[model samples]
Target: MKTAYTAALSMLAGIAVGAVAIEGLHAQSTPKAYVVSEIEVIDQGAQNAYLPKVTELIKSSGGTFLARGGNIFAVEGEAPKRVTIAVYDSFAKAQAARTSPEWKALAPERNKAIKVRSFITEGLPN
Candidate 1:
C-alpha cells in the first residue's frame, strides 16, 4: 500500500510540474513586426548624420535594421530615388519603443534632417 501511494504521488507531482511549465511559456510576451520607410531629403550632404542615429534607434527598440540602403531598380516611369526599409517586432512594441531614451535622442535628426514614414504591419501568423 505504501509503494502504491508513493507512485501515485510521483505521478501527481509530474503533472503539476508540466502544467506550470506550459503556463509559463504561454505567459511569455511575443514580439510583432513594424515597418519603416525613410526618404532622403533634397539636400543629401546635410542629411547624412540622421542615418546612423536612426540605426541606433532601431537597435534600442528591441530590433535592428533589416534594410539600410535600398536601391531603385526599375521605377516603371518614376524618378530615381533612394529609400530604406526597416522592420520591428510589433506595432505597439515599436510605438512604445519610439519613446525610448535612445529614440528620443534620434528623433530630432529625423524630423529636420530627413523625412521618414512608418507604420506597423502584421507579420506572418505563427
Candidate 2:
C-alpha cells in the first residue's frame, strides 16, 4: 500500500512539473509585433536630421531594429528608397510607439524630411 501511494505521489509531482514547463514554453512562444516603414527621402538634409531623433525614440520604446536601410537587391517588385523594420514586445506596444505623443510631435519634422508608409503586424512565434 505504501509503495503504491509513493508511486502515485511521484506521478502527480511529475505531472505538475510538466504542466509548469509547458506554461513557461507557451509564454515564451507568445508572438511579437513588427513595424515596417518604407520611406522616401525628399530632403537629404532633413532626413539626416530626423534619423537620430526617431531612432532614439524607437529604442526608448522597447523596440529592436531588425533592418534599417541598407543594401537591398529586390527579388521582385521595385523597393522603396529606404526600409526600416523594428520588432516590439507586443502589438499594443508597437502601435503605441507609433502613435505616442513623442512620435506625433515629430510629425511636422518627419513630414518635412521624408514620406513614409508604415504598418504594424504580428510576428510568428519562434
Candidate 3:
C-alpha cells in the first residue's frame, strides 16, 4: 500500500512539472504585434499641430516606435512620403491602441494634417 502511495505522489509531481514547463514555453513564444503606417502630409501647418498630440497618445498607450518618418528607399514599388512603425506586446493591445477613445479624439486633427494608411500585423515570437 505504501509503495503504491509513493508511486501516485511521484506521478502527480511529474505531471505538475510538465504543465509548468509547457506554460513557460508558451509564454516565451507569444508573438508581438506591429503597427505600420504610411503617411502623406497634406497640410504642413495642421500636421505640425497634430504631431505632438499623436505622439503623446501613442506613448500613453504603451507603444514603442521602431521608425518615425526616417529616410526610405523603395526597392520595387513606390515608397510612401513617410512611414511609421510601432510595436506592442500583443495583437490585442495593438488593436486596442488604434480603437481607443484617445486615438479617436485625435482623428479629426490627424485627418486635417495628413493622409494615413495603416495596418497591424503579428510578428514572430520573441
Ranking by lDDT: 3, 2, 1
- Candidate 2 lDDT, tens digit per residue, 1-126? 999999999999999999999988876787899999999999999988999999999999999999999987888999888999999988888999999999999999899999999999998886
In terms of TM-score, which candidate is strongest? 3
Over 1-126, each residue of candidate 1 has an lDDT whose tens digit, in order, gives: 999999999999999999999976654544456565646575565577766666666776666667656566764765335555556656566767766677777666667776666565656634
Off by over 4 Å in 1: 1-31, 73-80, 99-105
- Among all windows of 10 consecutive residues in model 1, the one with the lowest summed lDDT is 78-87
Q: What is the lDDT of residue 83 in candidate 3?
A: 99
| Local distance difference test, candidate 3 | 0.94
RMSD to true structure for each model, in Å? 4.8, 4.9, 4.2
Ranking by TM-score: 3, 2, 1
Give model 3's clash tally.
0
